[model samples]
Target: MSDPVIICCAITGSVPRKSDNPAVPVTVAEQIESSHEAFEAGASIIHAHVRNDDETPTSDPDRFAALKEGLERHCPGVIVQLSTGGRSGAGRERGGMIPLRPDMCSLSVGSNNFPTRVYENPPDLVDWLSAEMAAHGVVPEIECFDLSHLFQAAALHADGRLPQRPYCQFVMGVRNAMPADRVAFDAMLTTKRHLFGDAPWCAAGIGRHQLELNEWAIAAGGHART
Candidate 1:
């Protein structure tokens, strides 16, 4: 039998704001509230990203600690997965937020242009990030945005950096990268072909294609969001 899927509700992400969805929470209290709501909605895990007063992305350990405490008290053992994808080029956000020592944290396995800006994580930085996760005993959730990125992730695994059965978050459909269609779908399949032996992966499509890619992942004998 296939393993049970882990549904991770990305409650209030860095990109989404109150204007987009009035229910999108920005404050610590509101975040807790939204998390509880998602929990009740059948999400056993949460993919979180913290925001500052101005709603900018912030890797504040205190904020993470507060969320952890609230989850422990109210949710009672729900997994909190943090995003290492910083808003700006400051690579510090990923390592800076490590004091929380979350059960799982993301590792964007490759560099890609995010809209007008580039999200850089070259080989050296990736190795460092993986080693840090290992040192802290936290599971690295490999976030792959392209086929080559998946290969890169496998390369890291081969070099004895990533875990034995690593977790993957395959992102599809972004500008300046893979498109969001059957052609993009094939690329994801290519990724699976390479990384399949090394990990259990969950997939997501950004922007308008989120739902479609998610469905593809669910149908293809992989873990997926409900």
Candidate 2:
């Protein structure tokens, strides 16, 4: 038998907006409400991204603090995993919330191409972000868009940057990044096991591939993100 699946619910991402879908929560309060619903439905982790008043992504620590407070109050033991994705901000701005000491923060160890632009996570920035997370005693959920990211995570761990057995999240089906192909997914899973050795991992897919990746990860006895 496999370990039980851990459901991570991304309440609002960096790209979507109320205009894109009014259901997308923009305010701190709205996010809490949405996250509570997900918690009730079986999501143990809330992968969060906050926004400015105009519905644009912002890496404001105050907003993240507020969201963390509300989620803890409403959802009890739900894990608050804040995103440090490049879309939220530039350079170190993306890691502003790390000091707030959420249970985990999304860490992309390598850079990759997004739909229209390069998602830059330069070595210096990655080192800074990882060091900050280490200093704050926060765990990092490595966001692996490409296979190289897994190896990078291993290197960081070996060098005393990342915590032991860092949780990983495989992101797939993003235009120029890894596709939602089963072969690639299997290779990623195999590589993760080869490098990390039974460390917990999850899979998330973009847009239409979301459900497919969720099914694949769970069926493979790993984890899923919705």
Candidate 3:
């Protein structure tokens, strides 16, 4: 029999406002409802980001607390992973929710280009964020937008900044970042095996490449992010 693979659902990201998609969940209550649905649909993890009443992203701790509480109550046993993505906030504000000690938090170890601007995760900030996660006992899911990020994650793990073996996530198909090329995907998988053998890994694709990346990750025996 085939083993079951974990599915992490990102219900709402920093981008994609209600104007873009009226169905996108923005408020805490709406997020909870959406998350419950995803959980019931076999998503074991919810990658969450809070938004303002006006549908703008915010790194508000209270918002995260409410979302975490609701997810725990409704989704029950689903992993809650707060995003530390740049679009939500800058510098230390991005890690504001780390103290909540969710099951996991997304950590990007390096800088990369987004669709319009640079997504920066400097070394000092990365170290600080990792340290905070370690202190709070929150496991990090390494977000590797570039191959270099994988090695950086390993280095952080080796130096004890990352207290545990992180769950690696390869992000592809961003306009100025890694493309969702089959050869690049294979190289990422090969490199992941060489660096962190048998450890859990997942793949994420932007926009139109989502399904393709999901298929590729599953066919290769890894996990998938939606």
CA RMSD of each candidate after superposition = 2.0, 0.8, 0.9
Clashing pairs in 1: none
lDDT of each: 0.75, 0.93, 0.94
lDDT of 3 by residue, 1-226 (tens): 1879889999999889888889999999999999999999999999999998888899999999999999999998999999998889999999999999999999999999988899999999999999999999999999999999999999998888998886899999999999999999998999999888988899999899999999999989889999
- Per residue, candidate 2 scores C-alpha lDDT tens digits across 107-182 of 9999999999898999999999999999998899999999999999999999888867778899999999999999
Candidate 1, residue 215: lDDT = 81
Q: Which stretches of candidate 2 lie over 4 Å from their true place?
A: none
Q: What C-alpha lDDT, on a 0 to 100 scale, does residue 93 get in candidate 3?
A: 98
Worst 10 residues of 2 by lDDT: 1-10
TM-score of 1: 0.91
What shift in Å separates residue 58 of candidate 2 from its native position after superposition? 0.4
The estimated TM-scores of all candidates read 0.91, 0.98, 0.98
Once superposed on the true structure, which residue ranges of model 3 sit more than 4 Å away at CA?
A: none
